[model samples]
Target: MKTVAICSGKGGVGKTALACSIAAIIAGDQKRVLLFDGNLGLPNCDVYCGIEVGCTLGHIVRDGRELRDAVVPTKAGFDLISGGSGWKELAQLEGAEIDALVGDLMVLADTYDHVLIDCAPGVGNRVFPFLRASQGLMVVTTSEAASLMDGYALLKNAWDVNPSLTAGLVVNHVGSPAQGRGVASEVQGIVGQFLSQELEYWGSIRHDSLVARACAERRIFASAFPTAGPSQDLVDAANAIMGLGVEAEATEEISMLGRIKSVFGKKTEDSEDKAA
Candidate 1:
């Protein structure tokens, strides 16, 4: 299973949008996907995905619910686990508690092929723990200088906390094609040169009025519109994630009959027949 985090140093960069899009595409492809709305204090995932949550990550931790019970299903065929709603509770955990919390989250990995975490903006405690649990990190940024700088800062933080963490870049709000390429090049250069990390360009979401429109309607634009450029770009980004091409190989190939036989081979009667 691959644990991918969609995070940004600053908020309002369409991080949740990118995360939800990835979750939708992964689920659509028949892959079991779970998305955690790690942005606890300013939680909007439930609203964006049109899900009314009975339980959130904050509730599970503070209210004494099991982690399994915190996961809520959305209309897009994916699961969502949310974070704390109250700002005071967001940074209210100690180091040990954070460690224990992440340990519990690992159990879900066994049941999912992809777990996409939508981390909160800025370098907060909430962001790092999620980053630690993740196998790969994708930083969402815009064309603004401050956003680019924050993206680098987040990359630096990730490296400081975990040296082996692989990172990806998803440029959002590209007002123009030229500006998009420049943003990608600038961010990728900083990561490659200063951090000594290869930044995976997961593609960009062009500036679209539909995005804001959907947010106003409190729904994922991708699922609602389906044909919007931003929505299409998000699907391409999800494909890029799954197509990362991690190595997994079986020892040998089985024939069609052998494959069918293998399914039934687990039966006690089949075992007896083979012995006989």
Candidate 2:
């Protein structure tokens, strides 16, 4: 499966909403898609898709529940693994524990065409494991200066951990397409110049009231308002992401164990840098 982690450095930038819409769009095309709400501290995938989640990853980790049992099918035609909200224990998971979780997830990888992880915003511990495991990392940001700064920070952190990590940028809530492109260009230019990293502009989502209304109704805006501007924007973004050919790998180059080791190794280096 092509694993993609959707993350942002700052919250309230409509990261989860974009993830749900993209997953729904792909699933609507009859592709088997698995959407995991990896925002362990504050997951809202269930709320966005209007599904009631009984068991979560927390049950699997803490209570020894089966991973497959925690996989809940949503009305959007995709399977969802809901993350635990207010579960501080999950936030404290060590590198080995995170690898164990990814190991369990790999069992279901062959069953789906795509696995979209809606990661929690920021450069926190919970974010890197998914980034390391994923073949593609899409960072969502708005036109605001703070959002762009933080988004670049997130990209830098991901690259620092795994230099081989492929990443893209998605500018959301833009007033115009040109505006979005400008924002993406600025961020991409900075990353390329300073970090020697290139960020592909996957696409952008337009600012529309329909998106807000759909979210308020606890439904995916793409499905609820298919013809809306924001909906079409999401469709275009999904198409761009698919064009990246993240699934074209002949073999898995990085195993779960490798991911864990890489992440932990980077953590140690980062701590040392701080101490220096």
Candidate 3:
């Protein structure tokens, strides 16, 4: 099973957005998907999945309930286990408590083809164990300098803990093409030179109002507005993960050659008409 933890150093940088979207795409393709909302202090994956939950990871951790009891199904053909709202218990969990939670998490992880863990912003003690346990870490960041710096800090900490941990970077809420490429290049350079971490280049998502609208409505953007740019970008991001060719019918954005031909085709047509 492929376990991926989606984390960003700073809050509100589209970590959950990218995690849920990738999970949905994998599920849509008939892969067994399990998503754990590790952002225990601020749980929103449950809301995004539209599952009303009476129990969550909080119950399992604080009340000594079984992890199976906290599993909640969602409309997107996957199970969501919430991290719980109150983090009092999580903040003070002992080494034994962390070991127990990790043991339970492994059982759930074994049941799916892919497990996506949505981590809260930062590299706190609570977040460290989960990041280490994951198969690989996917760091989500924006073009903002603060976000990149924090992401770097997380990468550094992860490296210090284990130099062999596999990691990839994803730039979120990218405003323009230039900005996206710039951020990607900057991250790749740093990871390559100093940390020597493997940086998988997942493409960027343009900032769109639809993402906010869908979030406010407690729905996923992919299902709510599949035709939107963000949705298409999500699809591409998933395809990249699987190392599969992207669908030609999904969006107008295509290979560089295809784009050039279309532009020249339009120019040629205009010139022909003027000559005629």
Candidate 4:
């Protein structure tokens, strides 16, 4: 399965909402999509979709429950592995524990066409494992200056962990497509010039009040307000993602456990270098 991680450096950028809408759009197209909420500390995919989650990854980690048992069905036609909110222990997971959890989640690879991970905001430990494990990474941001900076930071952090890693950008809460394109271009230019990295523009989500209303109602905006501007934007973005043509051979080369260990080793080497 092709896995994608939806993340941002700052919160309140509509990351989760966009993730849900994109998953809904993909599922609507008859593709088997699994929405795995990887936002451990403040999981809200279930809340955003208005579905009551019976269990979560928290249960699997804390209570020794089976991973499949935590799979919760959603009205969006995609199964959800809810990241139940307020699981503090998740923020403190070590490398081995992360490897175990990811290894279990990997078993679903053969079962779905896409597995979208709604990762936590920021470039913390909780977010890296998901980012490293995924085939594609989509960084969400707004038109604001602070948001762009943080989004760039997220991109830079990801590249620092895996320099070969490439990511796409989604400008949310924009007034128009031109505005979104402008913002994406600025960020892309900066990253390419300074960090020598490349970022793809995956399209943007317009600032539609209907999206907030749908979220307030705990529903997928693509379903609740399909005709809305933001909804259409999400659909377009999802289509772009599908067209990304992620290489199956490259995806197969990514072992979550190995990636985690490699990242740890890199960090350790960097630390020792600085100490010298």
Candidate that scores best on lDDT: 2
Each prediction's total of clashing residue pairs, residues at least 3 apart in sequence or on different chains, is: 0, 0, 0, 0
In angstroms, give how far residue 138 of model 2 lies from its true place: 0.6
Q: Tell me which of candidates 1 and 2 scores higher on TM-score.
A: 2
What is the Cα-based TM-score of model 2? 0.86
lDDT of 2 by residue, 1-276 (tens): 678889999999999999999999999988899998888778879899988888988777788777888899888898999885777667678878877887778778779988898998999677888888888888999999999999989999998777877788999999988998898888889999999988988888889988999999999888898899888878776776565564444234456668889999999999999999
Between which residue pairs do clashes occur in model 4? none
Q: Report residue 196 deviation for candidate 3 (angstroms).
A: 2.3
Task: Report the lDDT tens digits of candidate 4 across residue range 162-275.
Answer: 665558899999999999999999998999999888899999888988888898888989899888898887876797677655565557567766799899999999999999
Candidate 3 per-residue C-alpha lDDT over 84-170 given as tens digits, one digit per residue, 9 for 90 to 100: 776688656766677678678888788887778898799877677777777677788898889999999998887776565567777
In Å, residue 5's CA in model 2 sits off its true spot by 0.6
lDDT of each: 0.79, 0.86, 0.78, 0.85
Candidate 1 segments exceeding 4 Å error: 87-91, 248-276
TM accuracy, model 1: 0.85
The Cα error of candidate 1 at residue 167, in Å, is 1.2
Candidate 4 regions exceeding 4 Å error are 246-276
User: Which lDDT tens digits does candidate 1 get at residues 193-273?
Assistant: 977888877778889988888888888787887888888778767876776535331223335567778677768677898
Query: Which of the predicted structures, 3 or 4, would earn the higher TM-score when compared with the native?
Result: 4
Better of 2 and 3 by lDDT: 2
Off by over 4 Å in 2: 246-276
Question: All candidates' TM-scores?
Answer: 0.85, 0.86, 0.83, 0.86
